[model samples]
Structure formats: C-alpha cells, structure tokens
Target chain A: MKETLKLFKIGGGVLDDDAQLHRFVQAFAQVPGRKILVHGGGKGASQMLSDLGIAPQMVQGRRITDAATLDVVTMFYAGKTNKQLVALLQASGVNALGLSGADGNVIRAVKRPVKDIDYGFVGDLPANSVDAATLHTLIQAELTPVLCAITHDGHGQLLNTNADTIASTVARALAGRYEVELHYCFEKNGVLLDVNDDNSVIPQIVPAQYQQLKADGVIAAGMIPKLDNAFAALEAGVEKVVIEHALNINEPIKTVLCRS
Target chain B: MKETLKLFKIGGGVLDDDAQLHRFVQAFAQVPGRKILVHGGGKGASQMLSDLGIAPQMVQGRRITDAATLDVVTMFYAGKTNKQLVALLQASGVNALGLSGADGNVIRAVKRPVKDIDYGFVGDLPANSVDAATLHTLIQAELTPVLCAITHDGHGQLLNTNADTIASTVARALAGRYEVELHYCFEKNGVLLDVNDDNSVIPQIVPAQYQQLKADGVIAAGMIPKLDNAFAALEAGVEKVVIEHALNINEPIKTVLCRS
Candidate 1:
C-alpha cells in the first residue's frame, strides 16, 4: 500500500481576498499527511496590468497572455502570492516550499500551439510533463510544495498554464508512487443539486452518477469541464478526487469522486 | 576529500541590464561543478514601485523596506528576475532551480531588530542561517539553485535581505562540506590599481596585500566593505573568493583572494 498524498487546488476566489486566503492557508496547514497546494492566479495580476496602462486582450472569451501580461502574472502568481502563501503556511508550522514548474524542471510545458487564435505565451501540458520523481524526493524530505500556475518550456520560455490542468496532471503523474487525492477547493460546499441552494451539495459522486447528474442538468455549466478532468484523472489511476469549500477542507460535508 | 562548490553572486548592474544578465547566465551555465547563483535586486523593483506611485522611503542612508516595497521587491526578485534567470540558465543547459530563502527553509533569518532606526521587513541572518545539509543534497542532485534575496522569518514573515550577505552566509555555511569558492561578479574587471584604468586589474590579493593596499589607498573607498566581507569568508574556510566581471567569468582577468 502506498502512502496517501493529498493535492489541493485553490482558485482565484479565495486568493483575491486576504482574509479568505489566510483562512484557507490555516485550514490547509491542518490537513494531515503529505500534501501539495496548487494555486490559481487571482485578479491581482489583471489589476496590476490595468493600473500600468496595459489593456487585457481577449478573443472569443479567452484572455490572450501576451509578453507583457506574462511578465506581470509571473510576478504576481509565482512571486507575490506564492511566497506569501508559503510564508503564511510556514507561520502555521507547515514546511511549505513554493515552486514554479521551472524550478526543478518539475513541469515542463509546451506553448499552446496557435490554431484559430494565437494564445501568445500560454502553455499546455503534454504526456510526461510532470517530473514525478523529483516531486517524490521533495515530499519524502517532508516539504509541502506550494505550486503556482506558471511553468516553463525546457528551452528558456516561461509560459502561463491553467491551475486546474496543472493540479490534475501532477496528481495523475504521482499516482504511480502514492495514493493520490486531488481536491478542488472553491467557494461552494460541493457539487450542488440546485445552483441557488447552498445546502444542496451531493455527498459523493461516481463517474456513472456524474454522467446522470450532467444529463439531469443538476451540475452547473462552468463546473462540467472541471468534473470531466477529475473523472479523467480517476480513470488514469488517481485514487480519489474531492470538491469542497477551501475553508472547509477538514470537514466531511463535501463531494468525493471515486472510480466506482 | 570534499567536492568543490562554486557560488556566484551578481548585483544590480548586471541584473538591471537584460543583455548583460543574459551574458552572465550564459557564462554561469558553462561553469563546471556543483554551483549556486545568488542575485541582487535590480532597479526594476524600485521602478515598479515608482510606476505604481509608491515613493521610496529612506532612513538616513538605508532604504526602508516598508510593506509595499517588500511586496514589489518580492515579486520582482523572486518572481520576474529569478524565474527569468532560471529559464535562461535552463536554456543554456544548466539545471537551475530558483528559490527564495522561504522555499525549503533553505535560509531562515531574523527580522532586523529596532535599534537607532527601524528597517521594516528587513532581515539579518545570524549563525546557522543557511541549511547546508539540504543544500548539499540539492547540489548532489545536480540542481543549481538560483537564489533571490528574499527570506522568511521561520515564524512566517518574508523579509528582504542583502544579496551579498546571503551569498557570504551561504558560502560560509557550506564550507564544512565543500571546497567552497565565492565569486562576486560586478561591472569592473577586478580590483584595480588605478581608479580610471580597467586594464590595471589585480590578478590576486592576499590578506597581507589587501591590508597594505588599503593602507596605501590603492583600493577604492567603495570597495572596502565588499572586500572586507570577501576576506571574512576566506577566513571562515571558504577556499577562494573571486572578484570578477559578470560577463568575463570565462576569462582570466580577475582578482582571486586567497588565505596565503
């Protein structure tokens, strides 16, 4: 039996608010066993860009990560937010080591190939992108890696990547050595039965039930892609995937997705 | 017999200029041995602060690292500059891993105590600040750690430290395990005999010679503190302390300080 490794991802909602971010860090520190925290870029980067007279370019609803934008976001996510989170976790007695994918060549990504629209400096993860062996060494050394949503192409390019994709890829890659638990933590309690009802969280979700939930229109449209990625990770040998509130990670009132 | 470890430090002049920084990284990647790079904050951080409308506050001669300044410097040093250097080094075939002292608890520092003046958010490293054992492991792993001058109080506060101090402390700490060589790379070719003559480079300087040169006013007044620190490291068992030009590491025109 392999040791349990919990991987938690926190998105922009919790990251944008200082009070909420501190609360989440406190809760995350309390999570027992070896763990890693993957954080998404918050509104801070965009705000900095606008403040610096740089207008964000978007096409077909997807933001374009140009050269200037990549520089700002890299500073914000990998620099300010990542170091702050690591400091806070350290204050709470957690031995957290912050990382950008470029740090140890831990996650080498490819620049998203231009198709209909050019995504400037955005990166996409391919097979064998995550360096699981190095991560295993860091974890076995008792360091919790706090990863930001920034990676690099091996040949000198730092590319911005989606945090969710990074989390799932890392979990799947590490599954060979550990029982991986991928947690998606956000504002909501769990996968909701009704979008308006905060208390309508389903306790557990399986792939079969997840398919039925999608057919019945119970799951939100925005959440479908996340769940699809989660299920795909489960298929790829990740032991479990959980969706819960960032603040309520230690609680039981959450949704767990299993292979069943 | 212990293996040799080369620790190089680059300050503001090289770091502020992109072309110069690239040249330095290229030269650094070619250095053959276990190595580490320590980088100082450039004018970019202050430029960002000024661009964002934060006037820098100076107490006496030293700049105060207020909360806002700390944030910008952290992002600039750890985020933009560190990652850029890492990417560039990786491109040049060096396995460079960027780190703030907070990462891996590699260097823990104490907040500069309030004395005649309070330098807010500034850190001063004391004895045993650098975790040499962990660094040894990282070097043994064939990873060149690219360190920024950002550290944390083990209790959670991220503090801005002097890059030169960080390099010296790291070199001294690792002295017991390796034949450590500390290199301070700047704009000049080396310690010069004539202030106006770049070609009058002192190829070597021993402690007795350094004292006589200082007595005769051959060394510039500004180079005193840096040379003092360099000699101090030589005293602390670091095998050699080299004062060289950032872009001329591969060349032989530099000063080497020795115990003899």
Candidate 2:
C-alpha cells in the first residue's frame, strides 16, 4: 500500500493578505500526513519592482519576464515569502524546509522557446522536471517541503515558472511512489455551480460529468483550463485533486476530483 | 571511523565580487567528501536598503538591525545570495540545498535581549543552536547545504545573525558525528606575521604560540577575535580549523590552528 501525500498550492490572493495567510497557515498546520506546499508569487514582487524603478514589460496583454523582473521575483518568492512561510510553519510545529527548484536540482526547467514573443528568463517544465526520488526521501524523513515558483536550468540560469504547473508536475511525478492528492487552494470555495453563489460548490467532480458541464456551459470559461489540468493530473496517475479555499483546507467544504 | 566533513565559511569580500564568488564556488566544488558552505551578507543588502529609502540604524558606532533592516537582509542573504550560490554549485555538479536557520528548524536562535543597546531584530545563537541530526541526514543524502545568516526564534520571528558564529556553532555541533574541518575563507592569504606584507602567512599556530603572538602584538588586533573563535572551535572537538584565502582554497600556504 502506498502512503498518501497531500500537496497544496496557494496563490497570490492568500499570500498577499497577512490575516488570511496566517489563518491559512494555522489551518494548514492541522493537516495530517506527509504533505508539500507550493506557493505562487504574490504582489510583493511587483511592488518591489515598482519600488526599484523597474517597469513591467507586457506583450499582447501577457507579462514578459525580463532579467530584472526575474531577479526581483526570485528574491521575493524564493527568499522572503518562502522563508517566512517556513518559519511560520515551524512555529506551528511543522518540520518545514523551504526550497527553490535550484535547491537539490529538484526541478530543472528549460527556457521557453522563442516562438511568437520572446519571454525573457521564463521557463517551461519538460516531462521529467521534478525529481521524485529526492522529494520522496525528504517526505520519508518527516520534512514538509515548501517550494517556491523559481526553477533553474541545469546550466545555472534561474527561470520564472508558473506555480500551478509546478504543483501538478510535482504531483504527477510523486504519484508512482505515493497516493498523491493535489489541492489547489484559492479565494473561491470551489468550482461553483453558480458563479455568484459562494456556497454552490459542487461536492464532487469526475471526468465525464466535467465534460457534460463544459458542454452545457455551466462551468465558467476561466475554470475550464484549471479543470482540464486537474483531469490531466488524474490521467497522469495522481489519486485525487481538491479545490478549496486556502483558509478552509481542514474544513469539509471542497470539490474533490477523482479517477472514476 | 567518522567520515570527514569540511565546512567552509566565506564573508562579504568574495560575495560582493562576482568573479571571486564564482572562483570560490569552482574551487569548493573540486573538494572531495561531504562539505557545507556558510556565507555572510554582502553590500547588496545595504544597497537595497538605501535604494528602498531605509536608513541605517546605528548605535554607538555599531550597526543596529532595525525591523526594516532585518527584512531586507533576510531577503538578500537567504534569498538572492543563497539561491545564486546553490544554482552555481548545481551548475558545477554539486547537489546543493539553500537554507535559513528556520528551514528544518536547523538552527533556532533567541532574539538578543535589550542590553546597553537594544539591537532590534538581531539573534544570538545559544549553545544548542544547530541541529546536528538533521544536518547529518542532509549530508548523508549527498546534498550540500548552503546556509545564509538568517535564523529565527522558535516563536516565528526571523532574526539576523552573524555568519561567523553560525559556522563555528555548526562546526562545534557536528564534531561528534564527523571529523570536522572548519575553514574561514577571506581576502588575505592567511594570518600575517607582518601585517604589512600580504605574503607573510603563518603556516601553523598552536595555543602557546597564539598566546605569545598576542602578547608580542605580532598578530593584528583585527585578526584576534576571529583567531580566538577558531581556537575555541579546536578545543570544542573540531578536528582542524583553516584560515585561508577564498580564491586560493585549493592551493596551500594557509594558517592551520590545532589543539596540541
């Protein structure tokens, strides 16, 4: 029997607010079993960049990561936010160790190819990005790893990566060894049946029903990509995927996606 | 027989210079057996503080770590400097992991109490600061830990600490499990016999010779505290302490302190 591992990913919404972040931390500490936390870059990086007089570079409504942007984000996400989270978790009695993808060469990414727009210092995860063996070793040693959204090319370049991609990739990679449960924690309660209604969280989601909901246009356009990604993770051997509010992780209200 | 572990400490001089830092990383990679690197904060943090409009807090000719200063230093040391070193080491085929004292609860420190001068967020490491068992686990797993001088009180406050103290404390803590060699790497070749001559390196110094050198004023006053700290580590069961140039670590002509 494989031991279960819960991997939770929280984004800017929870990270940017101190009270929410602390509440989430307190709730996260109560989660039992082997777990991992993958966090997204908050507004702090953009603020720092603005403070440092660096202008944001955008192409066709998409933000481009230049060298200066990468440095600030790396310092903000990997340094301040990650270390602070680790310290907070430690204070709550969790043996947490923070990591950037560069640490232990754990997640080696490749610079995105210049096709349409040149996204400077941005990385895309290849098939074999996450090092599962190293992660398993850490998990077995009773340490919860807090990973930041910065990865490195094997040849010494730190690249900005997507936190959601990191979470799924790590989940897929660790599936073979552990029954992996990937949780996406955000502001919303779950995949809401009524977009305006907070309590209309669909308790369960399977692939077939998800397709029907998409066909009926009941699922929001914004949620399709996330659901598709969740199903893909399920296809890639992850046992379960949960969508919940960052502050309500230990609570029962959530959307559970499973392989039927 | 205990396995040999080489712990190297490098300060601002090498870190502030890109070429020198890379050279030290290359030399450090070539060293065999289990090794760890501890680094101090460079001028980058101070520059960032100035750029961010945070003034230096000073108390009677000594720099004080105010809350703002602590935050900036933590980000710079534990974030930028530490991650860059880890990436560089990974590029050189060394599996490196970056750490703040809060990571893995590796080194829990106490915030310095208000004395004549209340140094706001500075931390002082107690005797039981470094967690040797966790370090041993990391070393045995073939991961080279690159530690920055940011530690935390167990109560969740991140504290700015002295890197030299961190190195010696870690070395002393791990001496029982490994035959530890603590190397203090700096700009000069070694401890100089004539303070004026750069090449006047002292090859070896025992306790009696150190006392005599101190009495005769042959040892420069600036080097006394560092040397005293080195000798104390020797007495605390560390097998050896080497004082050498950061770039010339692979070369000879360095001072070695030993217990006779």
Best by TM-score: 2
For model 2, residues A148-233, the per-residue Cα lDDT tens digits are 99999988899999999999999999999999999999999899999999999999989999999999999999998999999999
Per-model C-alpha lDDT, please? 0.93, 0.94
Q: Against the hidden reference, what TM-scores do the models get?
A: 0.98, 0.99
Off by over 4 Å in 2: none
- Model 2, B77-115: lDDT tens digits are 988999899999999999999999999999999999998
The fraction of reference interface contacts (C-alpha pairs within 8 A across chains A and B) present in each candidate is: 0.73, 0.72
The chain B TM-scores of all candidates, as shown, are 0.98, 0.99
Can you give the DockQ of every candidate in the order shown? 0.80, 0.85
Q: Tens-digit lDDT track for model 1 on B1-260?
A: 99999999998989999889888888998899999999999889888999888898899988899998998999999999999999888889988889999888899999999998899999999999998887887788788999999999988789999999999999999999999999999999999999899999999999999999999999999999999999999999999999999999989999999999
